[model samples]
Target: MVLLVPRYDEPRLLAAEMELIDQSFGIAMLGCALAGFILALGLSIGGGHPGAFPWAVALAAACALGHFGRRAIAERLSEARAGLYARGMTALLTVIGGLWGLAAWLYMDVHSPATVICILSLIAGMSAAALAVFSPCLPVAVGFFVPAIVPVWAVFIATGDSAYLAMFLGAPLYLAVLMVFARNYARVARHAIALRFANVELIARLREQTARAESAQHEAEEANRAKSVFLASAGHDLRQPLHALGLFVVTLGRSELSDKQRQLLAHIEAAAGAAREMLNTLLDFSKVDAGVITPQPRAFRLQPMLYKLENEFAPQADARGLFYRTRDTTTTVFADPNLVELILRNLIANAIRYTNQGGVLVACRQRRGCAVLEVWDTGVGIPITQRRAIFREFHQLGNPERDQRKGLGLGLAIVEGLARTISTRVLLNSRPGRGSVFRFALPLTSQAAQPADASAGTPGTMPSRPSLHGLRVLVLDDDPEIRTAMTALLQSWQSVCVAVESESEALAALADFTPDLLLADYRLRGERTGQEAMEAIRERLGRVIPTVIITGDTAPDRLRNVHAGGAALLHKPVVAQHLHTAMTALLSESGWRPEIPRAAGMRMHG
Candidate 1:
């Protein structure tokens, strides 16, 4: 019922207070034993009080009996039992206080003032210790303090001496001050317990939230992995047909046709090209995430790459009625030429796509021993808030309708990914409507630039077409449409072709024919892969033939496996010119020189 003890409705707080009382109960009992023994001995020895020793011994025994079984009582403590335990402990404490008061009564008749003062001093020490030990529960502390010292005050008043009466009057105020101190101490202890419980509850809730978050993250990862698997499977299946379609269109282009037919064919080619570009973008993103794109840095002239990009994007810029310029520089930077060229190409293309009224600029300069290549565009500039988000995969600004013309929104993402592959970071500076500048720096090298390939001019420029006539080529693919299209395309170039549907058929073709080059599709029937077929053929021939692995799978793990085989890889829906370039380069390395017919110069367009 005391304010220091929480109400029964709050069982937890009440139980906590009772537990505190139990903890300090032993201290209270120990103080009682010591004070009782000392008081009784002092009275008997110094004041000749004969009965004090026997009385003290009996009370001490009773106090020890009450202190026993405390631990057992606490173990089974409950709300109802807590009240009983608190009342019982207080009762025991009050009985001990009465023992101290009895010592005062027994020693009051002592003649020696020193002996009387000693007894009073012993009683005061016991009451002060009890106050400290039981203050957390005010009722127990008050019970002990009142009984232990009030009896001495009574003795002082009974003497009727002026000094004793004065002391007794002040004693009540002293007790009242001690009671107020006990009350404040008890309130603070209760608040601390409440805070402790609140903190414990908060910790439990936090742990639960953390567990839920971990579960959600695991599910998200699973869903992403499933998505990658779906894309990889679908991409391979779709690329087979699309690859055949592009090759068939190229074959149609080679044949004689009217102007209208040619114009229609051009439209089909453009549509197919667009699809191929989108697929390639996805493949590039997957390769970067899969950690398959390793940068091969070397010294290469920046001017040649810039020229190639201009050639590539000039027509688009012209159609959009936006001027495109490239500032020429002899800066030879150290970086993977192919990756750097890809980064610049994406930036230039993105700039041209967004700009409607102003021009785009591609420039390079030397700074801090690095080549700071920049693409500046007077287009719809990116907002400051969207700058960082633009680097995230598939995130786009101002094109929420998901228009195909605006691209798949992967250009900047790929740009950032490729830059990271080369151990560099892309920097962006932009305004809302004026323009945007994209920049990244590559380490510059003093080494001489590698000799530019005579056959490999600028990326979009075709230097010359090498004759594939009289060149023996072998192709392995599972899809019948792909095999038929590939045979027709290779034959159109005047190259002898043997296209087979399986490895067994291809190996059978070798019985009467010798092959100069091998083209194998990456994924084949059953658990077999193109790498296995290539290894088998090479082992049988006892010589390493020039081989290229053409695949449509864009999954990161598949890319890593294809790269690990150390074969030249070309994605599906291969542009005719790109295929020719790859095959021509491989054959040249194998010392196969094609005899070019003395005809007008022919350009094979993709």
Candidate 2:
């Protein structure tokens, strides 16, 4: 493998050596030629050797011409022809070196010993310069030096003097030293070129890897977006039937039923509740992932919020035969009230669900300029190993059978996501078989505590049913089941309901009966939305009635658009009691009356 690798790199090394030689060739040739010309002119004029002067001039001219010719050919030479061009350059340099040797032999006879010494020194200097210039290619360096120096040494050795013989002896040693220097320099140059090529290849590979990584990241993001779209569509479709079923269940509870039937209804209701919870968890995760939950921060009294939470979960804890306590604090907090409530709700709910024997405690304390809200429970505590994993989606500790009553594992996940949205941190302290304490901090505000309203009832409490008798309400929904179920529920409440499927139907209904309120499903059929239907109905009726937008879409953009319409918004599979509460509030706030003349044919559907 090692031998093959070097063989593969041999061509590149040779090319690099040739390139160095080619680049320096012309410059070195012209410089040496010019220096030799000046020296020849000085020696000939000083020694009065007119005969050798013409030869020196001719030699300089030939060298100048060779430089220009080599430069012109180098410009035209492509990589495929570079080897041929390099050999030609080597031959040209050898010829120039031979001319220098010939000039030495011819000029030495016509000049004194001093002039001869000067000429020999110039020739030696030129030979050294050639060695440096052609070192990138050892064969070319050898070609020039051998012919240039050997003839001078031979001429000197022909003399009988000891000094001449000594000069001949030193010439071969000098040649040998120059050859060693050239070989070392060539190896170094080849190594440098190989390193440069390796770096270029490395950089190219890194760029390719970076591009591939970015492409993979983009594809992952696209797939995630598609998943969100699918979930939103599927959730909406699923919610239509569930919404109608919930309303029907609530209406059935109002009717008389036998003991067996009543138990069956209770079972159905429990199943429905579980399904709704799982669906809501999926929707919440999609919403968080889509970044739809925007925080509306405000200053609010912590005591009232805690009291509300206590009231909401107290009944559930009581049903399970467990005590629920809340330690009230007058401290005010600066945060998004809704998000804070949601985080605490999830934490308390989890605590209540996990605890088999003991009660849950909700407490607040002023600590380090913040109100630290804690939910402590004496339940089956979490093991240290499983603490971090508990907050992950769908990760339950003790629910291998997936019990509905034990709850889906998304509560803590939702809690973490909401806490992050509100810029708060959730801390956990627990030991297996002991209990768990979940704590989160809220910044305390200097604002005075807003007194809790006596009129404001506990969370999840139904309002006193206001008189719906003779009240006209318009409901626009695309699903017939939901439309029929809503009409039945509203009529049961003694309200005159006009339910329609599309904008055209709603407009026709509006012409016949003027409604005091508008209830709409956000997603509708055939190039129209519930918001547009409501607007069209209001325009036809010539009055602004109170509106409610119910949706199952958890897509961020869709949710934000519906919220921006300035209507009371509700998500699908909504609690029937909460639906009624919202309706009561909107109706009471608007106090709107039917203004359009009622058509004689306008009759209420049961």
TM-scores of the candidates in the order shown: 0.83, 0.75
Q: Give candidate 2 misplaced runs (Cα > 4 Å).
A: 1-9, 26-133, 136-195, 289-332, 347-365, 374-413, 426-439, 445-448, 451-463, 593-606
- Worst 10-residue stretch by lDDT in candidate 1? 597-606
**What is the C-alpha local distance difference test score of candidate 1?**
0.79
Model 1 Cα lDDT, one tens digit per residue, 44-122: 7877777888888977886787778555575435775776676777777778778777777667753468776787677
lDDT score, residue 62, model 2?
Answer: 67
lDDT of each: 0.79, 0.77
lDDT of 2 by residue, 1-606 (tens): 221111112445656777777677677867777767776776667776666667667767767776777666643345565666567766777787788777777666522677777777888888888877887766677667777777777777766578666677887777777777877776787778889989999999999999999999999789768767877889888887899999898889879999999999999998888788778877887667666788977777877778888777998999888999999677788888878887888899999898878899999988989899999999999998898899887789889999866776889988889888988889999977789999999888776555333225654356676656666778888788888778778767767778777778778776667877888898888877778877777777777778888999887778778877868888889887777778878887887443343332224332
Runs with alpha carbons beyond 4 Å of true place in candidate 1 = 1-21, 37-115, 165-170, 173-177, 180-224, 314-323, 328-330, 353-359, 365-369, 399-405, 443-463, 507-514, 593-606
